[model samples]
Target: MSKIRKKKIKKTNILLGFICVLLAILLGFILVTSYKSEQKESRHLSEIADDQQSGIEDYEAVKERAKELEEISSEEAEDTEDIKSKNTEDTEKTDTAETEDADKTEDTKDTKDETAAAASGIVCWGDDLINGEESNTYSYMAVLQKLLTDNGYNMTVINKTLQGGGTLSMMKMAGVSDETIQGYITRHQQAANGAQLNVTETGIRDLTEEQTTRNDMDCIPVIFMGYYGGWNHDPAELADQQEQILNTFQNKNQFIVVGTRPMDGSVTSEALDQVLSQKWGEHYISLADVTAQPSSTYEAQQAMAEAILQKLQELNYISKN
Candidate 1:
């Protein structure tokens, strides 16, 4: 071996060692870069999965909320229906009540009308004050009848009158003869028989017989005395006769007693008038109290008629307006 050949082999060995070190460094660098890239990709996939789960949860929550709102809407709709049904029932009940009230009012009116129509009986019994002169067209009684008719009353009036007489003459007019009256007094011996006698005045006898006849008539009587001075009898006897006449129809029928026209300003007339009024109570009517004038003129007669009608209304013999 020569020295020059040994030196060339050493140089070749050093070159091979240098090339191997460079290749190893390059391979390690490449392996490190690949591992870092794979780790980053795994982390990105995990983040994507988390985001998807969150979205699913949010969607389920929204769906539940929507179901609750639907239930609330359904409940509100049912409440509205209930309110409408209750309103309809209330309206029906109100209408029914109104109809019933109308029916009752109509029935009451009908009953009142029938009751008004049923009052129809009246009688006027008196002397010239009620009967008037035979020629007089506007008699007080006639005027009263006209007024009652005009005011829509169904009334029937029967007039019984004696022009110039007291109780005894009135009995004669009612079909009782003087002999029949005497027979009654004779049979009863000062106590007048109710069946056999019909009488008053002369003051000698009771008037039970005359009263029986009036009751048979079934009518209201209006008696007017003080015209003939009790047919020439004693004042005490006349007073007794007057009392008996009044007692005859006291409770049997509602009768009227009229004050006489002032006859020469006699005290007996005044006394008789007072006694009659005291006995008759509210049934007594005084023409002087109504109008100070005698009922000779048409106007005075009409005024008296109006007063009498008003008294009748007060007595409930007729309706007052």
Candidate 2:
């Protein structure tokens, strides 16, 4: 209880206080470093997503094409509703007897329209793209079919896009074996190979043509399977998965690849498209150049379909004549 003992106790307290302050400073530094690391990771993911939302270019061409197709569609609808416009125009000039004859002629035309010959069927397999979710307010495939038929080509499109399905379901629909389908998922997952944003595990696969028909050899398989790959996946990996899928086809000449743009509007795969072009030249198609709208619209769908039709003709799937 003397002065020396009291002084020793006070010095001990000071040393303990210093050690506590040093530990607190170290802890604070560690916490800040950890927080910054997490934030950087978050920013990286957000940056990747932001990047996908870019690449929407050449929008005026899409708008112009849409304007033309919409006008044609309007005229076609009027013709369908006013099939006997000539007779109506001449009704006031003719008597009741002449009108009766005209009615008979109109009846024949209606019958002919109702019993038109069956069209050559083209098969399309896709995901959300089928629903106009890709860039329009309606099924772009419908417009694609119309573009063919309205131009004197005898063709009908058969869409096999499942309403709420994914790639796995698409493969299953195509009669891919369970083992093969599983391999597809595995192949894609391996290709994805990222921290947590791999997309194949999140969505679906696609379909084919030869498997759907027993005797219809003319059916051409058109496939669009890039949504899962382009959504949150690395573009190179997406290209890899697409290459793997194409290799799975027994006869590469029998199918067409409708290249996909991610929902966020980025290009699906420039390298893959190049690879496809180098191999089969024009067997590949993409709507990215045809559209640059930030959102879907009827016009965009029509324009995209028109673009596809032009490509089909270029590729000799449809006769130029």
Candidate 3:
């Protein structure tokens, strides 16, 4: 064939080969750039995953620390409560012990004072006015004993009064008369079984030797007899009876006599009260304006006891401490 035609064909073939080579190089460059970009995205995702894991771990660690703090606080609170409770218990125990000690001390002092009272005493005598006629709980002698001891007097009281309204009967109980208890009982029976003499039988019997346990040196005598002391209501007769009763005790001068108006103040009762007040002086408690019935009441007995307590206080029979 022609030489020029063959040369032109070869040039075309070379140009096509060069174009194919250029296209292959461009495709390789694009593939390599895509692969590098994919690798960079994977590295970024890995870094983000690592950061999230660290954050989760930090949150768990913080929760554990908070739980530890809560446990420590609970233990501290329990310890504080225990200490407070122990302190309160100790205080209560100390207070109770102190109160008990005070009570024991008071009891000891009272026992000592009571022992002193047992040695020295006061003896009382009257009709139903001072006896167990109303109620032994309201007995002036019993009440007086309590009052004396309460006021630090420490004085015991003995009652020799008759429940029945008979001055001779009371004198017999006081061992100031020779009248027998059986005789009194028999007389009571004759008077429609008047009163019980047996209740005060321990007071006396046939007794000059009965005075061995008691004497004027340790005892004081008190008397109030008006209801049936004498049917005639004579002041001289009452005075004679008073002398006899006073003589029964060894200390006749240190006796207390309470005189009250009988029959609502006849001249006899006034004269008797005046005579007793003059004779006994400071030892006499006069109730000349008070009626016999009023003097026999329980309230009157309490008043009489209060007056006796006053006189005893004036005589300095009680302790100040």
Candidate 4:
């Protein structure tokens, strides 16, 4: 081989070696850059995964907090309901106590009024027909009470008539045992203690010694009719018995006779009226003359009671308003 050719070959080999080394160095740089880029991407992905995990934990905490808030709300609601129920019970008890107090106060006022009235003069009435069961429209005693009250008089009217008997029975009752008569008056007072106007069916027999002495009885207006239990009584005998009863009173001037028309056609009302008028004179009052017949009827009884009240006022037996 020639020396020049050998030298040129040697130079070419050296150049080629240098070129390979440069290519290898470039490849290494490229590989290192690619690995660094991959590591950066992995770090970004890890950061994103950490953020997601944190979000999940926050969501769990929020859910737990919501559950706690709900439990608090439920407990508060139960407490509110219990408070409302207790308030309602207390209000009801207060209302009941108030009503009881009001009733007691009213009862006391009524008793006081009754006591004051009982001390004053009391008007008395008697007769089977007048003291009978009250009718739908008007009771004779009730009518009399209203008239007297309208005239500024507070009076308690008491009926002293036997259930089935007439004037004879009234006389007998007047002569009863003093203890028995006193007991009846006591019962009547007890029953009337709280009433505005007491109209009792206890007959004149209830007029005991205690009543006459303790209370000022101004007048006893008697309504006596002959007819009773579908039979007519003798007017003369009935008047005699009535007079006997009136004599028992401490003040005979308090007796006022009133005659009623017979319900039956067998007996004339004028017959009894004449007998009463002859005995009692100006003190006698005829129901038929004052109003109409059938004093048992509501309208007729009302008119008769009014007329009797007027007569009592005219005669000055009761104080005028």
Candidate 5:
């Protein structure tokens, strides 16, 4: 119980204290390293959020464009209503020369103005661009038809691909029991690589002739939307034939020609580079470009449609001449 035993106990206490200090230092180092790593992760997340904010801005730009188009469309609708009222009043008057002259003037301003008609809206033509309930081509047509209707064009958009009307739906309509109708369907099926047409060639030729005449009547400008390649045909050759068909309209002032190649990677195989590279892909109008992979919901389609409407407004189809 003397001085030597007391000194040994003091030495033991000092060694224990040294070990505890080293342990505390190691624990503090671990905690600091973990905190720094978490701070780095938080900074990285902040950067990601900033990038998403930029994307939102781009999307919002599209939205703003849609809103502008809605405003323009509303104004056009009001103008259309006023014009209809004026026209109604004119119709009630006598068929005198003054009335006729007034009518002519009005027509010149509205229907007879070739430049205005051509610039204001598009007339789309395809086998079923107007009325094939089952055709995929009609899906986009419905969208376009809705656009035209929304913008104040109130006409029944024709679907020339039906029976007794075209090669596909030739015999589906009434009183068309010509045996040649069956023959036409057979030929068309063979040409279409086993795809049957419900229409007869005679009917199609007749409809084509009728449409040709109507194109001259200044009723509505027509745009024939045909596939570039079908049944092993060359796109360039088809484009040429389409050009010829369009020329038959006589009054081609209100017509536009557009050819869409299938987007199933067949455009390259079918040698449609001329159609694709030159006139097809411009203005983002090709169905392939906009609809390769559609968004899952109507909301997305509506958003995309709105974006397209904005782009069209920018083109100024409704601007005063």
Candidate 6:
């Protein structure tokens, strides 16, 4: 063995040893760096998981709020609908009430107008009703006037009686004659024609003068209260007068003819009732066989007026109000 070769071998061994040490140190450093990087990655992943959980909680809270808002909105809409429906119904009811009130007011006004017309001018007539103080005559006139006023009719009553208070049969009184009857009828006709008179006549006008006077005042309305004593003897004239008076006056005048008094059941009022019924029809002619004279003249007139007023009411000439 050579000394130079031995020394070279030792140097090579030392160099090899240094190289192995360097390699071991490098491997150790690399391992430590890799471990540190892996730990940091694990921490970052945990942070991300926490953030995701928080996000899920926030999303759930938002869903609950949205549901609450929807419920509140639905309730508000329902309340508004109900209020509108009630308002509409109230408006309709108010309109209907207003319309009914207006109609009632109009009807009231119309009734007032009719009453005013009726009150302005009206005429009424009765025979024994206006004449004597001996019976209920004056009292009956007062009652008739009161009734006329209440019914909205202003009326004037005319009576034809001699100076002496007498019954409706005054024409046949002891001192009276046909000429006197004619004069009486003429005077009555003239009185009725007067402007102040509303034109109503009582008692039969059978005399020639009476006929002429009645014809002269043809424009005036009349009412005949009693039958003529000569009417039974002259059926033709009686019928002619009946037809003339009925046809002439028509809706304008009224005639009520009382037949001869029933003396001990000898006379029946049927004949007079039939004639009147045929002349005025069922609605206008009221047939009544008057019993003994009323206690007063006022009662008789009231009864006659009542009958006429009832007829007028049936005809709708006056309203219920």
The residue ranges of model 4 lying beyond 4 angstroms of the native Cα positions read 1-125, 128-137, 176-219, 223-225, 229-232, 261-266
lDDT of 2 by residue, 6-85 (tens): 99999999999999999999999999999999999999988977765552333566777899999999999899768677
Per-candidate local distance difference test: 0.58, 0.59, 0.64, 0.61, 0.47, 0.47
Write out the backbone clash pairs for model 1: none
Candidate 6 residue-wise lDDT, 56-75, digit = tens? 89888898899999999999
Q: Write the residue-wise lDDT of candidate 4 on 1-321 in tens digits.
A: 999999999999999999999999999999999999999999999999999999999999999999999999999998998898889888988998899999897875665344433334444434535442463236666687777788887566565444444433354455634454445445545655755422222344344554334232333545453444112244665576567666665556554677764444535778877887898887787877877657666777787778777776555555533
**Candidate 5's residue-wise lDDT over 1-321, tens digit each?**
989999999999999899889999989999999999999999999999988998899789989999999999999999998899888777666456678899787775565344444543443344433233434333444555566568764433443333213322222221233563455445446667756532332233434444433323232333333331222344554454444444544344334333345434445523554563464333333333444443323443344344444444443333233
RMSD each, Å: 14.6, 44.2, 18.5, 19.9, 33.7, 15.0
Segments of candidate 5 deviating more than 4 angstroms: 1-114, 118-122, 129-138, 152-156, 162-232, 262-266, 269-273, 276-284, 294-321
- Candidates in order, TM-scores: namely 0.45, 0.46, 0.46, 0.46, 0.36, 0.36
Question: Candidate 6: what lDDT?
Answer: 0.47
Model 1 spans > 4 angstroms off: 1-120, 129-136, 174-216, 231-253, 261-265, 268-270, 319-321
Total clashes, candidate 5? Answer: 14
From the highest lDDT down, the ranking of the candidates is 3, 4, 2, 1, 5, 6
Clashing pairs in 2: 136-297, 166-204, 166-205, 167-204, 167-205
User: Residue 183 CA error for candidate 1 (Å)?
Assistant: 11
Model 5 lDDT vs. the true structure? 0.47
- Model 5: per-residue Cα lDDT at residue 320: 31
- What is the Cα-based TM-score of model 3? 0.46
Q: Roughly what TM-score does model 1 have, to 2 decimal places?
A: 0.45
lDDT, model 3: 0.64
